[model samples]
Structures are given as structure tokens and as C-alpha cells.
Target: MILKKIIEMKKVLVINSSARTLRSHSRKLTEVFVNHWKTTHNNSHITFRDLGTENVPHINENWIAAAFKPETERTGEEKEALKISDIYISELHQADIIVLGTPMYNWSIPSVLKAYIDQVVRVNQTWKLNPENLKNPYIGLLENKTLFVLLSRGAEGYGKGEYNEHMNFQSDYLKTVFNIMGVHNIHVVAIDGTSFDPEILKQTIQNSHQNVKSLIEKELA
Candidate 1:
């Protein structure tokens, strides 16, 4: 008899932050990525978070106090305040790969996604602040994770050195935020010109789907 080693399955977290449901291009991108990933990683565990429909409350002063205060010393109200944040953080911690799909709203991310970001980027949880080094204070805690940013834009030319590069706040902001959380292995795929002609939009979406498939093969291989 021959002994074989069994490999553990990876955990993937998928976040969708588009306001549109049936008509959301970003959601379509995520669906494509998830389907392809499933085909490649048959046994992988996937967790889905739909910020478009689900309401992730914006962090208030109570949340700030709860997050900043020591866990042992937190009051009942403070603990309650951080309940949602804790849940979001737990999901992030368990995920080996994160897939974020969102449309560029007003040249940036949706407010709901921003709220989710605020919830997860907690001090002493996702990252730490080095007091001695003011210049380089942020120390990310969630290390060795892969992030896939699938973006949908109404207009084109948002890549590096592109015509509308300066106007792109979506990709850069997301990359920076995840980088701060210690996710260095990042892959971005954007489906641009969503507001173009029907045929052009369809082609662009197809290209993005192919790109996602290629990326999965290349990155996961």
C-alpha cells in the first residue's frame, strides 16, 4: 500500500459592493471569478459578503472607542458596538484569498464598501501602530493572504500611465488599504467602459472574464 498526503483546502472570501443587483457588472465579474475558482479549487471553502444588499453600519464614536479600548476592559455597550466589526474581522482572518468586486462610483468605491473597510481595519486587530516610529507606524497583522480586486468602471483608461489614471481612486485606494492589512499578493482586473455601446460592453465583460480565468490559472498554479 502506498501512503498519500492530503492537502488542506483554501478559504476564499468574496465581497460584492455594487448597488445594482441584476444589472451590476461588478457582480457579474465576481460570479465569473467564483465559478472559475471553484472549477480550479474544487474543495476550497468560499464565504460571500454582499454589501450591496446587506447594510454594514458606518463606524461611529462608540465603535471607535470599542476598537481602541482594551478587550478585557471593554464595557457592555462598547462590546456591542464592535460586534459587527468582530464578525467582519473574523471572516478576513479565516480567508486565505479575498475577492473584492465593486463598481467605481464617482471615481471611487461605494460608501458601503468604505464602511466595510472601516469595520475591518481595526487597531490591535488587523494592524498595529508603532508609537516609536511615527513615520512608519502601521504594522499589518493579516499576513500571507492573496487579494483579487475585480473592478467595473463606467469610463475607460484607469490603468497605470493611462489617460484617466489620475482620476482612478478605486484600485489605488483598495490596494493601499489591503496593503495596510498585510495582503501583498494583490491581483487587479478591471472591466472598463461599462457605459459604452451594448456590444462594446459585452466584449469588455468577456475580456474581463477571460482575464479572470487566466489569472486564476497563473496565480494558483
Candidate 2:
């Protein structure tokens, strides 16, 4: 019932995961996409989280133990972990649309984004294992949401060929991880070759913007 009611409000959250500042190409491209998405989804309000500069701390052994402990046995550390979990869960619960500015680093997503994921993807908050079903491992908690990831890569030819195909753990991993958290529909706009020719970079940005506009129209329709 709550899910049905909350579906009425469409909130979009844009997460900037690159450590770089305004000079970051990935952030610039994602901004363009977000602007276009705003034109179409006029009713949606955007919230931005800069995870690169404000990084989430990694979960340690104590945090892990606290997560598994019964509520009654939880110490002050567990309570703190729960507080952190609540903050992340609240953000996720409030948003209907999620957009991420992810730059490919060493063939994978930036470390900051990965850390943020670790914070948000809690066992009970995002998903739970269905013990009744032996084959089905998880039951998703959140639903009716869309995620758009704008990926920036240094080199071109990552699409189907080029030595970088196997190196694309970024998009594939995001798809798998977010899927586990119950986000079924995901759109990726991979802008490659930021280090390429200047003219090509400008053209790529323009083309990606057009692609995002088309995607927004289709999704909103």
C-alpha cells in the first residue's frame, strides 16, 4: 500500500561519483543528461549526492558483526550502523529515479561509488534472502524505480571490439548489483574517449545528450 501511494511522486537523485571537480568529463555529460531529463520530467525534483568528495566509510568487521546481530544484543556500534543504514534507506525510498555520473577507472567503477553501494545495499533494507525458495536467493525491497548511469571512458572502441570489451566490468557490475537491489530498468549512456580528439569529444557529448532526450521521452511515455 505504501509502495502504491509513493509511486505518485517522482523524485530524481543525481549522484556524482567521480573524484574530479567541474573539469570531470563524466560529470559534465551527466549534467547534460540530467538537464534534458528535467525538461521532460518537469514535476520531478532533483537531489544530488557528491559521493566522491564526501565518501562513505567502508564497512569493517565490527559493522558486519553488528549487521548480523540480533537487535537485543546490538551494542552502541550497531546502533550507529543502523543510523547510517537508515539515512541511506531514506534516500533510496524517497527517489523514484536515480542517475549516476560514473567514470570508468581501471576497467571498473570508481572506488567511491562502490563504497556508497556498500553502504546502501543492506541485507534487510534493500533485499532479503528468501529461505523458502532454494533457487531464488533474494527478494527485492524497493521497486518501481529507474536508474540511469552515464559512464565516461578514456579510450574508444569499448563497444563491441577493442581490447577493452572484457575490461568493462563497470556497466555489467552496476547492472548486476542494482538488479539485486530491485532496480529492474537501467539505462546506460557510455561516453568514451575523453582523451580523444577535441572535435570528437564535443560531438560525443552532443550525441549523448540527444540519446538521453530520446530515452526520457520513451520512459515518460
Candidate 3:
């Protein structure tokens, strides 16, 4: 038998998009951030999901049909699709904070995260349209939520105004999508130059760590 305990836990959801194991730099940054966050926010609970390893199926016709079907009339198959998506959305709802361990792949987020997003972003679930104001759209499910994105890249200087900045669709796209879901505050911490000099990569990681620490301090204040 499994023991069930009840306590006030500040749920934190961490998604790994690298499709690799803990060896990935993005994963490394996420782990460090979570560890420090846990220490700072003692007694808080955390749930970690490896999106890369979750084997979440790509969205298909059946999934779409189920997601759109009215709750009262949904069939067993439809319920199953909803159940899968509910698991993801439940975590988001429970979470007080979210951390996405993302790595730039071809200047975009990984397919796994995309698949997960498809599962979670359901109409009338995470958001809904306003009939009165057809021209005005609003989403409030995840309002006031905070998100931290830890990104890694093999190349260097992908920050703003860099030659490769325009190629960085990962952070910008994430911001837009999450914003649509009503997540207002988002932070991006990048560990670039991984494929370059070892010294530079080490320094970048250290600097990011400091930045995250300061952010946490500010948030707690």
C-alpha cells in the first residue's frame, strides 16, 4: 500500500527538453537552480518531469476530437486523451513556480516540449474566448505565475543584438506561448559557448548562477 501524506507544498514543475540525460547543460542549470531554490524555500515540495523521457505522443485527430468534445458527452477514448493532458495541466495548476530546461535546437524548442504544449494548451481549459468582446482575447488561468527558462547553446553570443540573436526562437517563442496562457513573468538564463573554450563556458555558468541567485532574492522580497 502507498502512504498518502497531506501538507502544504509549493509545487514546482521542471521540464527537461534536451531529450538527453542529466549530462545536458540545460539540465545541469535546472538542477542547480532547483537545488538552491529548495534550500531557500525550505519545506516546499517539488515534482520533476522528464519531458524528453515521458514518451508523450504527438497530437493527432483523436486527441483533438477529445480535447474539443464537451465533458459530459466524452467517450472513454476521449476521456483517456483528456486524462493524459490533465496530468500535465494539473501540475501547472499546482505549481507556484515553473522551470523549463530547454536547449536550442535549430533555433527552436525541442519537439518534445512542443508535444507537451499541445497536450496542455486546451481551449476552455487553460484559456477561453470572450464572446462579448470578439476583438479582445484574454487568458487568466495561469495569471501571476512565474517561469524560468534555462537555455543552452553550442555556439557563442546568442544574446540580444548578436549576429545569431535573430536565430534564437527558443526563448522568444516560449515567452509568446506562455504569455498566451497568462504567464506574465518569465526569465531566461542562457549558458552559451558550450562548444567553445572550456574556460568561457565555466565562467558563463557561474555568472548565470549568480544572476539566478539574485533573482530569487528579489522574488522572495
Best by TM-score: 1
Question: Which candidate gets the maximum lDDT versus the true structure?
Answer: 1
131-158: candidate 2 lDDT, tens digit per residue: 9888878777879889988889988867
Instruction: List runs of model 2 lying over 4 Å from the truth.
Output: 1-8, 132-136, 160-163
Superposed Cα deviation of residue 85, candidate 1 (Å):
0.2
TM-score of 3: 0.90
How many clashing pairs in candidate 1? 0
lDDT, model 1: 0.90
User: Mind giving the per-residue lDDT tens digits that candidate 3 earns over 104-128?
Assistant: 8888889999999898888877777
Off by over 4 Å in 3: 1-9, 131-136
Supply candidate 1's per-residue lDDT for 164: 99
Clashing pairs in 2: none
TM-score on alpha carbons, each prediction: 0.94, 0.89, 0.90
Question: How does candidate 2 score on lDDT?
Answer: 0.81
Worst 10 residues of 2 by lDDT: 1-10
